[model samples]
Target: MAKDAVLVLGATGRIGRLLQLCPPEGLALRLQARRAQAAAGKPDAGWRLFDPLEDPAALARAATGAAAVLCLAGPVPGRGAGEMADHIRLGEAAVRAGAGAGARVLLASSAAVYGAGSGLLAEDAPLHPASAYGAAKAEMEARAAALGAELGVPVCSLRIGNTAGFDAILGGWRPGFSLDRFADGATPRRSYIGARSLAQVLGALLQRPALPPALNVAQPGTVEMAALLQAAGLPFAARPAPGTAIPEVALDVSRLQALLPVPLAPADAAQLAAEWAGLEPQLRQEQSRR
Candidate 1:
């Protein structure tokens, strides 16, 4: 598959942008987006404007002759049946396209699919999605698993947790977190992973010869929320509620490590918080809002 390449299905998202900036070496890329305009200056020779529901064939073509397909595309939040419908439709289309192209597919899922509780969450954890969004992600995970096996496509489902990439579209000015409270010394324990490290994880997975149809991709450790913020130079209201974990939520990476030579090193909270402080403006505002 030397001539073939890796296709990142969500080129417009935060992770997609980082991938564009530093695509894995030796692997060419096919970046699929909603519109050509969205991809205009981003790096990649193969750019396809695809609608998750209507353009399955085009998407299939894009994946055809590729080394692997990284399904990073996800829903734009707005809630309601319409939004839900959009996410499901796109998810179905992506799975179908990748299967048709006979490409190994690595789907980006969420930790929320595990719902809430406390403890280490293993890859085999029973799902108990709490929110509509979480439910949708769980559904996508199920569908991808079944379809991948049926189509004989190697699938690696990465149920990822909080991915921190401070200066990203997903990290843009939004509500809820602040940098000041952090400045004043407010910390809450939470879990987070860096975009660069995440990218490396994806790259390693793409090069794997075989992976389970589903897996969890996460950092091995957790961090205090307040300390996390302080490291980022941001502030927000403090809370004493201890962090909770969803049992059976960890992605067993032993299989992955065996297949690829690269090591997976998680970026710690201090580093992530520092990065977050430098990049996330809305987080600063949100902290101040409190």
Candidate 2:
């Protein structure tokens, strides 16, 4: 089997690190990070200090020669960076880079793109975002999808749900997401997938035969936020948003399962949520004082 070299954006993230672990056999892996100095000396690491807002051309150059580009870069909630403008810029950069490089791009989208709608969400569900964050995600998804068709590239977007696990990437101080919002009775029910499983899905995509651009990557199970906190031994209560209702953000993974060789399983979401809960207090304090 011919191997495909993959360029991973946001190479230092939780999912990005997992991409490094079991990359397709014989395919070279290149990493692009904001902080080249931080990524220096790491094996298979290629640092590109390209800001999403400033250097689209440089990003395209970095993405050149790659068979596939896995874009894990974007504004994350509570991270103080996933704001609407920033996310849009990131999406724009990704589209430009992927198109210029002529690489099959797999963009990391979010279930939040579906917004706070009722019923289980699917890839084609109506996007009615309730928050600026969700709106940005939806906009980015649309932008990437449109660019994929316009540029004549195989661009697929994965609407990921709550991804868990991995030590460093997602463990630090970032506020505004559900986990932190519902830390002590913040939000209600939600869905989650382990980072390992999320990585497995990405690996499966890398290995699968080329197809039309479209797919959702997520676990099957949907766990409530309160139960998740309890599982993690944290205070469990209802931390409802004032004007927002938390809708079920389930990414139907059946499409990917039908196409891929291996199936993804749901790990202990509650346990994973609990673990993050344990760190919430400390993280909150660190951020408050900052």
Best by lDDT: 1
lDDT of 2 at 72: 80
Least accurate stretch of 10 residues (summed lDDT) in model 2?
A: 165-174
Give the residue spans of candidate 1 off by over 4 A: 1-4, 42-44, 166-188, 239-260, 274-290
Tens-place lDDT per residue, model 1, 1-290, is 36448888877676776676557766777888887677555344578788766667777778788878887887754477557655555666666777777777788777777777356666676888887777887888787677767777676777776777532222542356532233334433334666666677777777776787666665656655445554655545533433342223334444444555665555477776555445446434433432
Tens digit per residue, CA lDDT, model 2, 1-290: 75676777777665665665545455667777776564655544555666655666777778888788878877656455345557666766677777788778777777777777777666677888766766777777778778777887777777777765332223432343234243345445556766545656677686554744557666666666545545644442234455455535566667766876766555465656654555446444433442
lDDT of 1 at 46: 70
| Candidate 2 Cα deviation (angstroms), residue 220 | 1.0
Question: lDDT scores for all predictions?
Answer: 0.64, 0.64
Among residues 3 or more apart in sequence or in different chains, the pairs in candidate 2 whose N, CA or C atoms overlap within 3 Å are: 75-82, 78-175, 182-186, 185-239, 186-239, 232-274
TM-score of each: 0.80, 0.76
The alpha-carbon RMSD values of the candidates against the true structure, listed in the order shown, are 5.8, 5.8
